[model samples]
Target: MRRDELEGAVREALSHQVAVARPLSADPAGQAIRRAKRIRRRRTGAGLALAAVATVLVSTGMAQLGGDPGRQGKPVVVIGDPNPSGRPIPSATVTAAAPTSETPVDVLAGATLIGVSGGRLELPGVGPAERAHLLPSGGWLVVGAPTTAGRSLWVAQHDGLVQVLLAGAGSIVVAPDGRQVAWRDGTGLLVAGVVGTQLIGPVRTPVPGKAEPVRFIGDNVLVRLDPDGPGHTLWRPGVGELTAGSDRSTLNVYGALPDGRLVGQVSTDDPAKTCLAVLDPKRDLKPVLTGCGPELSPDGAGAVSGDGRWLLVNGWVGKTSGSLLVDLRRLGQDLTAVPAGPPVSGEVAWRTESEATYVDGAGKLVQVNVDQVRTGKVAEPVSVPGVRPGDRPVLVTG
Candidate 1:
């Protein structure tokens, strides 16, 4: 009942309250600050969005998140990339979900530009890519959207580190070995060595007419000049000289075979038709083989297999817009054709010597097997999850 007794009772009550009470959050202010930082980071990276409509892969019943369907994976951010904005580079590998029963069928192919993880397209950190070339080092040199100068060129490493290589760049090509890259940046054609992800010892040479490097064959680069004509040249990087072939005026070279022979479309008697011709460069570029493949597309939308044994071209197959597969081994033999559902966009990519893929009009990725087509069968179309029709023309490397 004394004053000291009353004080002791009050202190005991205060101790009990402190022991039982809890803070609203472990660190409410710190949490709020972290949330604000994340939002700002997203806003800063908004300009890097390549698609008009952002896409996210939704895991089907095959893969479940916390017992429910969910987005595939988190965005991977790599720091200290060459980006001036200091934005984290989103690694393509991170967005891949584990394979599911609904996963698209994958075929053996050359290295793809973007990671097709789990049979789905893992959109890279680069802009809307118009074309991509695979680097021998397991990376990609991506050609992005058009700008005032030209298209933007970016290098995406295998690790998903994206760096803007050059802006306003014209047609670009990576050497067969992936050791070098050449591009026309309006001023002239430039060839640069590629080490890891960096450009080294860039050498420039002025080229006349509208020149675009097409392919790399041995030590020479095949260049096409004036898209409308049969003007082509072979140039050696850093040599500063363009060599015109004896057949340069007549042959519209598409690409070279593994044996260094040139494959191109030669004029036929009918104005509407052209022969899928092969020119032996060793023999003064003379046409050794001349026979039009089945319905070779007028625009020549096709590609040759690495071995040069097969040729695939886009054309009509019984009134259906499709791709024709020809056996170069037996040029006069029966031709194999596969219908292209929707309209075929972008060029076809050889997944392997016998398998190839292309994005159709519907933004769906479709694969074709040479063996299956030879048997009079067609491969099924695989829908690229999360991709809408408008997200095309999706650039998958050839």
Candidate 2:
């Protein structure tokens, strides 16, 4: 099957569809618009393999709804009762995980590229950066501070050379391994591999009207369509296929583990009732575990430790600000929520396997240890050398 023919078939399958917007109140990403009518289109199984390849050709239309290897090929787990517990789990006795060999990445102060450990990586041409991500190659991907003209992404080489990657780019996210990046552009979602200071093999794939890249699980980039909605699509760059998103309608994917399991909120039949579920993306988004509670919702900012053992999320516990620390090793069964000061920023960066740092309401960096969280203790907030009260820091970890 040729690329053009595959794309043409996809167009024919989608021609009858008309998109209508509806509002969803329980959207995890906050406000969101839902599709009122969906045209159920299907294609022959034989063409499924080719559909994945056609996605890389850079089309302006949606990918074919054929068999996505990432979703269709994996076995789905059937649980007799999805949620055995009818109520929210406020706390649990956590089992400690074996130490891992994963190396932790350093925290870089906002735009300035100042490392928390020490020293600064000066980006020559790039203006004050609002966001900085550590690349696997020991470089940095920074988003220039926004102005009346909008923001852009710039790459600073390990040797201190700087160059702009994309202009008017937002929702920019680097893969967990720091090899690939995906961001929203005027046309749609664009993804590319990073090698040193240059982007290799950039591919533009069409997505919904409003979308944001959530995180990467291996080569597949999870994207949330509808901007404010829970709707998501897993863009598989390795196979060049953009999946129809999770088949589960109520599941709102937030953070992902290194092994490709997704940690997110699952809404029940009742909108007010929601719980955390760990989903295996390869297994058709099957729920490996569920029923943590609404308090564990990431509320947009969530981070998984380098070893994929701990998941730290910022959210509300009752009326107070708090963070949920879940041990992924036990499939989210062992977890606890700790009261947090009003957050200076939503992001949380892990300093060690058991310790994570976040800016509190006082604009001071506060460290939270897993063991202390279990006993309801929080460390005193300390100030970072270069980060000022008004600065919002962006944290990345391997």
Candidate 3:
């Protein structure tokens, strides 16, 4: 046979054999395509998972380092129960007889004072109080001499509960919010709050002397004073100390305003006269009111109204002097005398912008209306019993 004819016959015979073979459902081309698609999907899923992990890691790093690390994860640490002894005190409710100028007053029964309306309550602890401050939350921060050897500082709640914060505390001051407290243990200044207690310093640092907490400059920062010197130190929890105020003569800081203005008495060169001054650390220390004598109160501390609009001065006028109410807005104005039958001793607290409450010499709680005194009119004094002559009364509002 011829070569071309034989090649054609072979090709035809091969085509016939391919058609007669068994058919396969799994085609090589289709299998290759599905395998490639599966590989592509796996790569895509892995890339997305890696991206998500990276995002989480970046966010966690920012939160750990960018903000205040000390306060980030810190929990509130409760020191003790406000009321240790489970016995509840009687709640007193006082209602006004009629609309009168007399401010509602209450006397301290033990360490608790229940107001006429029952809304104002102050539990200053059960023990005899050496020093006490009315908290903004209608509670009391009290320093008591519970034992013969040591002093106790406590935060007493309005619900007849008391929590002893420090046992051997010396000098202590509560913050404006009533949430934080700072006290002195020998030479060390310690601060405590819901977060916990932190020691600021011995204040003496390189030397040996005493230090005390003056007042809270801000919510988180406080001003500390060294009795031996005239300068003041600013203390923050995480941050170290910073110097505040000038190195002038030592000024006793009593109260502080929200704007960081300090209200206190400044010692003068003349021993006969001292002056009440409002100091701004950013400015020069100048006296706002001069020619002030000794304080009538035992602690020699004055009271500043909650609004920071008025100041109650307890100056000595022989032995019959009463506390003077001065308008903070009008610093040059004369002080209005709080009317009492006899000389008023102890501290006076502002019940309202125009009203003040104080304990008189006869151990009576007297409420004085400043507007009436300014107009030469005397509102009948509302006398409250149970408050002793030396009992320091502080006015509180709900």
Tell me which of candidates 2 and 3 scores higher on TM-score.
2
The TM-score ranking, best first, is: 1, 2, 3
lDDT tens readout by residue for model 3, 1-398: 25574444335433331112122222222222223233221121111111111110110111111132232222112133222223232222222222232235433434544344332233423456644555543445665643644566655433333454455455566665555666554434556552111111222111125546666666544444566545455566545544444546435555555566766666667655556667765454444444343443333445677678767666555665556555666544553334332334445566676776766545556666766766656434444543445454443321
What's the CA error at residue 228 for candidate 3, in Å?
A: 8.8
Q: Candidate 2: which stretches are off by over 4 Å?
A: 1-107, 124-130, 144-150, 238-243, 246-254, 328-336, 340-346, 388-390
**lDDT of residue 44 for candidate 3:** 16
Off by over 4 Å in 1: 1-93, 96-98, 101-114, 119-125, 248-254, 282-284, 332-344, 393-398
lDDT of 1: 0.54
Question: Against the hidden reference, what TM-scores do the models get?
Answer: 0.67, 0.65, 0.57
User: What lDDT would each prediction earn against the true structure?
Assistant: 0.54, 0.53, 0.45
Give the clashing residue pairs of candidate 2, or none: 111-129
Best-fitting candidate, scored by TM-score: 1
Return the candidate ranking by lDDT, descending: 1, 2, 3
lDDT minimum window of 10 residues, candidate 1: 56-65
Give the TM-score comparing model 3 with the true structure, all chains together: 0.57
